[model samples]
Target: MKIFIKTFIFLIIIIPLRAYPQACCTGGAPLSSSLGVISYTGENLVIDFSYDFNTMKDLYAGNSQLNDKQRERSTNSTILRFTYALNNKWAITTVLPYVWQEQTVRSNVGKTVQSSSGIGDIVLLGQYAILQNKKNLVLLAMGPKFPTGSTSKTDNEFGLLLPPDLQPGTGSWDGIGAVSYSRFGIFRPTLSLYTLFSYRYSFQVGRYDGQQEYRFGNEMVINIGLTDSFLLKKWILNPSLQFKYRNTQKDENNGSSFPNTGGSWMYLVPSLDIELSPKIYLHSNFEIPIHTDVVGTQLVTSFKGNIGINYTLNFKKNKAYKIKD
Candidate 1:
């Protein structure tokens, strides 16, 4: 039973990331866990607000590093997530984000800054609980990623079409498929473990000028992690650690594929969650790349950080909600 619980928790905790573009690197992998899906409730409505920061400075070609060339990119994203339980076994989630992106590149004319800001792609998912018990959970989720963000944003200073990597949106529709399973108390009652797998399939989109088509490469991610909760007098402290392996296929443009636009990456993430009260929760995560192998030369993220807060409203009149330690 203990081995089964450990294996189960190792596989389910990683599948909760909502699909969205992040950072300046066009091919950067999405965060493995964006919402509190691993720790959730039934018959309750949850609202989450989060902020993400990513910085890019290193340039890599294939597996070799090149000079930075005084080029840098940064992205700041604000996201809102709504999760509603239709009932005990069914739930739906919606995610909306606003992004601010900036890229600085050195040119013969000097250094120039290109930036864009607006709404990003939206994601909707339906979640079903395949199994739920006091110490284990199995879930299946599927979702459609919508192209509600602006793809044709222009840089007024350059008077040219900025590269797709610097855009706020991918401009393509996509689909997400995910599976997760989690188990608790493998070692101790306060210890939890989970693992998850997610895949994002991309559909092509035509540029606003009708001159070319841009398609973000398909993405696959696998994650495994564990968390332990410590009880305080009035506060619950939870710390987590996760490992993620992500791969992205090469992107296509106007029927031609681009190199250096997609590759495989591995990340180590550490996070913390605090339950301030029964209805309020706060979480934060920091991610660092452990290894990266790209198809061609591209800029990669150096580090990423995110923080979020969630508010839960319980509508189960007959049951009193309690925060778990």
Candidate 2:
């Protein structure tokens, strides 16, 4: 068991240390949100489906806010995720997202819009539980992002192709690694605290059109949160508050760093989880940006929200702890 744990840590650390690729910030992909401690035991399957909406109307330049609200960008994403535990120590998670993105620029020449809708990238992860107990859990996961989304969407007003950020998919292959620790019943029987850290690296690759080679900026995210439960009218309500910090490196376009594309951000996320039954759950969260500092002048997200449902199917039905819903 010790050997296996050391080997898993080595594998995760080596991937990020082997290469350091600077990444961009504008390409919004919900990869890190898919990871969590599924179960303490085996033979459990969890299906999660969610819809996320993100809007960016604020413009900033290196921590300084600009008065320009000329550009509005938004992404409406539908995501379906699955987690299956093979045993107490091994599991798999998959995320498939479909996105509709739009960007509108306003000027004296009127408004011009670029939009597209199609399937986005797919992520597959292999997860291992480092520690599993009644109240404590640690997880490590690494995965590959397959470039399966549509990149051929064009501008609505003009016949030109849209930029990479406006497209539903990035044409590059990427790698991600994550680690998380959770402690339940911290102070009370229903209180829990968790922290998660993840990093993503993008590979420089040619696009599907084979016209331009670009790489989205690598991204890093850190989340710390606490949850507590309350009972109301025979309903179990779990309310959580999380602080998220994200940083992205500059994007590489044709082997050169792109300006106004990457930076750091901090957000406050307040969420609610409702236990519908033993096998069903519902969740929703809203994210509000508390701070933003970009590499240069860039449009940034002001708000985002997500609503989802979770259904769990247990093959064994004989686990010591409940798998996280």
Candidate 3:
């Protein structure tokens, strides 16, 4: 029994730390509002603030070949999410993000640095509860992403347009749809499971730089997780393990597909959520890629970290009151 426990601990603590590929074309805030059960009673307002960072250093070709040159990219993102629940059945959410990015490329002449900082694209989503019970909950959501971020940022030293991959926005509008399902008390009283799937479809931009047409490929993401809860005196501790899969299509430029733009990746994530009070919660998570197969030679993510806080406010001031005659 002791050996089994040690093995489990090692798998959870050490296996997910290995390096992985950086995402090629898809660029958006890494944090999104979590899907949860809604009560059929008073209205609720939920706000979340999160910070995320990722580093990409090694380049890989096809599936397992590493290139010679050393190239690196780093990104830091801050995200804000707001959710309003009208009733137990319907909700709406908005997400905004600010991004700071740096790209370093190595060549025979030397290394060059390019950086950009701006507001990223905004996303608005509406969610509806399809089924809700004591043990299970299901939700459906759809949304549109606006190209509010800048795509024409230029480098400071060279005064030239930065690459499309480093731009804050994709220069095109996109649509996203999602389905989430969760089940509680499945194996034990303290264990719960959930799965979320989302798809994003991209639209073509006529002329991004007045000459070349550009469009990022459509993307899909899937996540499955299990959470175990422990009651620790006055606070509740919840630890979760999640698996995430992402697939993106190739990018198009001037009516032709670009190489090393998209691929499929799998990641393992471990997260912890701490409840300070009934209305306040803190969360942190780490993501590491385990499997990756790109179209060609591309930069990949080595590590990603996220930390956040969530606050829920309940209002019952406007509830219908009966007059006592």
Q: Rank the candidates by TM-score, best first.
A: 2, 3, 1
Off by over 4 Å in 1: 1-41, 107-109, 317-325
Listed in order, each prediction's TM-score against the native is 0.86, 0.88, 0.86
lDDT of 1 by residue, 1-325 (tens): 9866644442332111001122224422242344334334457788989998988777776666677556677888888888888776777888787888887665443455668887877878887778877887887788877778777777664344555666667777788878888787878997878788888898888875688888878878887888898988899998988887888888887878765577888889888888898788898888799888887666777888888898888887322121111
Q: Assess each prediction's global lDDT (C-alpha) against the native.
A: 0.70, 0.75, 0.71
The model with the greatest TM-score is 2
| Tens digits of lDDT, candidate 2, 281-323 | 8989888999988886777778888899988897886563432
Worst 10 residues of 1 by lDDT: 14-23
Give lDDT tens digits, candidate 3, residues 1-325. 9867644553443222212224554555543323322333458787888888888875777678486545678988888878787877778878888888887655444556668888888888887878877677788888888888788888785455666667787677889788878787887977888888888888877554478787888888888888888989999898999998888888887879776678888889898888888788898888888987888777877788888898888774322100000
What TM-score, to 2 decimals, does candidate 2 have?
Answer: 0.88
Q: Can you tell me which runs of candidate 3 are displaced by over 4 Å?
A: 1-25, 31-41, 65-69, 206-209, 317-325
lDDT, model 1, position 283: 85
